[model samples]
Target: MTYPQDPYGQQQPYGQQPPYGQPYQQPGYGQPGYGYGPAMPPQDQGLAIAALVVSIASLVVCTGLLSVIGVIMGHIAHSKAKRGEAGGQGMALAAIIIGYIGVAIIVGLVLVFVIVGIATDWDFD
Candidate 1:
């Protein structure tokens, strides 16, 4: 018995491109590569990271001064991120929150000390 031939028997020869549309255009070497989807945002800035570090350290050191500085830096980084001048918005926000908490803790401790000193009638020379 004779076998039937396959449909669309157009076989491309060696080293020959198939009958298709335009070829894929790739980005040049050393050029920024992009995906088929929308472009991604830039990487986070250093100031935001620094703010986070300082705010976290403030809690360990129990110093309100570092907390204040961290809060300031966080604000700056947050603003820049909002304007698209930098990234790390989340980190900056976290830093701000941590800094505020640190400041509150310090203030609460001071109040407690004062209250205890008054209640016990402690005298210092």
Candidate 2:
């Protein structure tokens, strides 16, 4: 009976390891080689993050007064991202959305209070 030859065309006697000087090496698994692909560099996301923070603060503490500033910053950040000058476009968009919602809520509440005040006559004596 003839045994199958190894990759180097050598048929070693049944399960004995190769010589110490010529050890068999296994192929690398699940790891990328050096400089395998192009990597994109990171961009600045300061404006986007600041906008998001300020927008959240407006809703939580400032009663929408700072919402307009947040919205402006968000727009600038979003535009920078669109032009490939920055990152965090999603965050900027969320800031803009939240700020606008805050502004709307403030306006709605003012309108409601005005209507209630007009409907009732209180004597200031």
The Cα local distance difference test for each model comes to: 0.84, 0.83
User: Against the true structure, what is each candidate's TM-score?
Assistant: 0.68, 0.67
Provide the global lDDT of candidate 1 against the true structure.
Answer: 0.84
Q: What's the distance in Å from true for residue 84, model 1?
A: 0.5
State the lDDT of candidate 1 residue by residue for 43-94, as single tens digits: 7689999999999999999999999999999999999999999999999999
Candidate 2 per-residue C-alpha lDDT over 1-125 given as tens digits, one digit per residue, 9 for 90 to 100:
22334566655565555565664433333356787799889889999999999999999875767989999999999999999999999999999999998898888889998888788865558
What RMSD does each model have against the real structure? 7.8, 8.7
Clashes of 2: 0
Q: lDDT of candidate 2 vs native?
A: 0.83
User: How big is the positional error of residue 13 in model 1, measured in Å on the Cα after superposition?
Assistant: 20
